[model samples]
Target: MPGFRLISFKRCPYVQRCVMILREKNVEYDIEYIDLSDRPDWFNELSPLGKVPVLEVTRDDGTKVVLFESAVINEYLDEVTPGSLLPDDPLERAHSRAWCVFGTALLSDAGDITMARDEETLAGDLERLGKKLDRLEREIDTGPFFLGAEVSLVDAAFVPALQRLAWANEFHPAMAIFEGHPKVARWWAALADRESVVNSAVPDLRQRYEAYVGRDRGGYRSLVGARIAA
Candidate 1:
């Protein structure tokens, strides 16, 4: 196996997903943690998109590749690594990918929606996420894992979001998406204990949430107003 370097940040859920997948695959890579508020000049040169979780992949033949986007990075890492987080069966693979999309696309957006305090749309958000969980609860009957007996990329992708949900529920006390979902509660708890998640290669989220929410009440308003005017 060759060496790799992961350019990431502490509080980004997208970055967290890449870290978990890399660790789960047992791929050895050097981590370069960046602070979003004051990103290093070097990072900007590498990721023109200015996003975290950019992987600097080095091959044994002295070739290098830099990739971005959390989902694409996870898929790429899985390609080079030994373990298979994604299923081989076409149907199962599709099903797993659905949850991956759910976590990254739909459920992940809920954080921004909630922070925006658009509580009126929260019921609809809960409905959509709940429906997915209802199906997931029914699909996995074999034990603790998402796909029968073992964890899959589907589970890995969602764990970080679920963790933040738990934090929000615990502190905010109003975002109660997990109130009635027993299966999701169980799965979230189990996933938290996973080595990749527990030993998060990043900082705590509560600090970020506090800062984000504070800004949401103040700076977010001004920023939105400025954008609209433009």
Candidate 2:
């Protein structure tokens, strides 16, 4: 197999998704970490939106193609790899895709909660996220993974968001984001031991994530908590 290069940022959940998939598939790939605030000129040529997780595939014949966006990258990878994370039926695949989009929305709204400027806004974001989580809870199958026996694209897609919530709780137990979502919580607990998920980010991911959220424009300084950094 021709090894690929992953242009990545250390902390972006979007990038984590792709990295996890590569890890899960046991693909031959190398990651080159880049600071989002100080990207090189060629990065603009490769990534239209200047995002992390731009995969550069060098074919056996020396041809190269750069792909961007986490979703597109995941889908393309699934297609090329032997085992499929998506469903075989067209309708089921479409449904899975829709859920992946929903997962993205959840991640976005959670970011809003982290950056909520006031207690009122924070409470509102929490309520909205709570309602959406209830929907997700209802949607969850009896699973160690998203679809029961197998882990799907949905699992890889949403695990990063779930991970962020878990780390945030370590600093500020206020959110209780998973309170009413037992199935989602279970799914997260299951992924906790997954090697692919574990290797996606740095070993000190909790601290890094906290540092970023601690600087949120909102009153999220609490994300760092009182504990001293190790």
Candidate 3:
């Protein structure tokens, strides 16, 4: 395995997923946090998609390769490291992968919730988010994680959205994101204190997330978040 460098923005959930995978794998890597609003020249050249969580891998011969997309980067990291975070059974592995994609959709809904500009929009976003959570509640049969005891890449992918949603619920109790979703709620609690999940983001993530979603952006959540902060 070569030296790893992760290009990230502090508030990016995708980058946080990569960070969690890196930590879970115990891979020694350097992280460079950049301002997404003002991306550097090198970054623009390095990342074709112009997104955060671009991973720079330094090969044995000092050659560099850049990998994009959280799912691809995470799988590569898992493959190069010792054990696998994916299930061994082919069907199970594919199932996990499918759920990981589902997690991405959940993240998109989360983004929508945060950026909702009005009550009607927020209500609609919450309804969409709730439907997804309902699906997760049905899908998750295990106690602590998506696949029972051990935390996997699926957990890594989902935790960022869960954490943010937890915060949103806290900032505005009316959201009640976990209501009627006992299993998902339990899953969140289970991963809440896990080392990788806890340390995946910046120490001030809660404050940063609040500011970014609430006061910093012009959204209804911002109004609610700002009021909570005040």
Compare the candidates by TM-score and give the number of the best one: 3
Per-residue alpha-carbon lDDT of candidate 3 for residues 53-83, written as tens digits (9 for 90 to 100): 9999999999999999999999999999999
Please give the range of 10 consecutive residues that has the lowest summed lDDT in model 1.
221-230
Residue ranges of candidate 2 with Cα displaced over 4 Å: 216-230
- lDDT per residue (tens digit) for residues 1-230 in model 1: 76789887877777778888878888787988888889888998999699887988888998988999878888888887887888898897887887788777535545653454345555666566667666666665655767757877887788777786676566545556576667777788779879988755555565665555445354443222222223
Task: Give all candidate RMSDs, comma-separated.
Answer: 5.2, 2.4, 1.5
Query: Residue 187: error of model 3 in Å?
Result: 0.5
How many steric overlaps are in each model, in order?
0, 0, 1
lDDT of 3 at 112: 78
Question: TM-scores across all candidates?
Answer: 0.82, 0.92, 0.95
Residue pairs that clash (backbone atoms under 3 angstroms), model 2? none
Predictions ranked by lDDT, top down? 3, 2, 1
TM match of model 1 to true structure: 0.82
